[model samples]
Target: MESPITPFEPAIADEAIADLQQRLKLTRYPDEETVEDWSQGIPLAYVRELTDYWSAEYDMGRVCGTLNQWPNFLTEIEGLDIHFIYQRSPHSDATPLLLTHGWPGSVLEFRHVIDRLSNPTEYGGRAENAFHVVAPALPGYGFSAKPRAPGTTVQKIADLWIALMKRLGHERFLAHGGDWGSLVTQAVAVAPGTTCAGIHITLPVVAPDPETLESLLPEEVQALEAFNFYQDWDSGYSKQQSTRPQTLGYGLADSPTGQMAWIIEKYAQWCDCEVNGLRHPENAIPRDELLDTVMLYWLTNSGASSARLYWESFNNPDMAEIELSSAISLFPNEIFRSSERWARKKFLNLHYFNDKIAKGGHFSALEVPDLLTQELWQWREQLRALEIVA
Candidate 1:
């Protein structure tokens, strides 16, 4: 349990870096398609700009310093090497908080925000609201070794986080996540009396039944229609990854640009777009945000390992049949979806459901950190008030 302020050791060796650049230089690329500036894949011009910056000026030393500013640790649980940042308030009674990441994302996504959540007073908040932050690189992503055994579902990950918390001396805690993170956090709440006292999620699990919706709100029925579009059209990447991850992983693991293109497409298509990202057909997500995510994947060499989670998740039979249990002992589930208005739909004792028209799309955290941060803080405070009443 050595708590190093920073745990990034430059996963890529110097020789490997040199070799990767050589490969990039010599590798044949697909002929340039339209220069349509991101309705297509990573624009050739934009990618060259990113790769040039990567080769010449993207500072690993500076980036590592930025990342290490918060306390970090490396621990082994379930025979897997777990790398996480555990930052705590100076307060003796600080509440524990665990944050998980989704695919195409790593612990690095929060490198810029972990400190604020941990010591809010220093970062600007009452010391009473301070948190003990635990942001783990999900198993098979970033420094965490990919699972050797298959069937690593959200359930096992929740169990692992409980173990990690107890090992760190936390008896009770709060949790937060988005995208795949929201799903895994749901699983965490399902675990025994580890009792996440309060939980917040960015990605809500509210895909309303379209048929039920069409009659309810005919004028705004398109919102529900978009759900069908996502199931049919937007899920190609998930289908490919879940079905033949190794095939996709081989290309991504080998080529930085290849990996960049693969991930950039998702951000461009799914994030912060107007018109459901499908209705507009032409609204573009900005380049800086896309490259921000790309740089993380490239620097960490986390592409192969990240995809392995899909392979393990898809093939797991238990995951296929598992259902969310309705139990009061666990924390309530929060569901966030992009729709007409921010609404809360509760289901018995199991649902603490709420939604907001947050500023971003799928990768909400990266697409709009300020909005995401505010939303998380607001939700956490709401839960804190509830805990006091209970």
Candidate 2:
């Protein structure tokens, strides 16, 4: 596969600076006594502070240079020019693993944890647990071909990643993801293959049994209530992404601040059990770092294509029955979406058993890379042991 010629993207330094100025110039000030708090979105004041940081102190060169330090390459797959970072561990026995990034998130999410996972010894991990990381832009997300058409969905992406692993000469491998990324990895898992030996992830979606929900202890039931609230109040972005992404794109595409505001709310709320989690001081990544996460999307002009994934899936012909089975509730939102029997009929795995990082929010790889790396190592070991014993 031929790599996409790295395009000469506009120097983000002046571009981001100029963009921030435009935002401040033409920005329509919102009413102070507005509807409510962040529930509606990032406060105008909050975004101004963030944009101020972007224009002044935010370091794009350092971030991009750090990204460039890795072996960035482009390859052709099914006619689309794909972009990725290929880092091979020196250890001969290092396992092969593929990591997927979701909406409004670039490969930058994994940048924090790549070395930790690929070189475990330096990170207090055994050499045997090392991995050769394959972090790819979801077809339209990063440097990969941003398909402007309507057909690409998570299923197609899973197939593409499978093909990608083969292209890299790996006959077998494992997968990990979160947010939309988690859903796609799960599809790859249910696929028939010995090569895709085991899959693990932080963002999980599974079915719940109504009878079980009825029988759960009071504490368990509380979590279920929170899950239901998310489906009702917290799903607007998902609904919009699945339906009218272009409309949202119009706003997000041109304005850097708009893009930051669009994704920052989710980063603040979706990764944690509560909105307060976004403000947690002990969190591995601070809110400023979270703004940096949004800037990646803004600088790359990915908000449109990233949100396009929603419309593709929601309109999928196979949408009638999304197969998701789990014996345990994975995310707080899954409780209200499906029943255990239904999920079983759909997804091969039901995760009703764990809340691993049940504390952290979506961008887990970026927010808490150490926690993500350590947990991923443990998951692989558990999967290996289970496969051997079985």
Could you tell me how far off, in angstroms, the CA of residue 293 lies in candidate 1 after the best superposition?
4.1
**RMSD of candidate 2 to true structure, Å:** 4.2
Scored by TM-score, the top model is 2
lDDT of each: 0.61, 0.66
* Model 2 regions lying over 4 Å from their true place: 1-26, 33-36, 192-194, 217-220, 273-284, 314-353, 356-358, 387-390
lDDT of 2 at 244: 85
Cα TM-score per model = 0.80, 0.83
lDDT of 2 at 261: 73
Candidate 1 segments exceeding 4 Å error: 1-12, 34-40, 207-211, 217-223, 273-296, 314-358, 388-390
TM-score of 1: 0.80
Deviation (Å) of 130 in candidate 2 = 0.5
lDDT of 1 by residue, 188-270 (tens): 76677665665566654544544455355642354456666667666677778877877887788677778877886665566
Task: List, residue by residue over 34-143, the lDDT tens digit for candidate 2.
Answer: 75566666677777777777666766564466567677777777777788888888777888888888766778788878899889999999887889998888877756
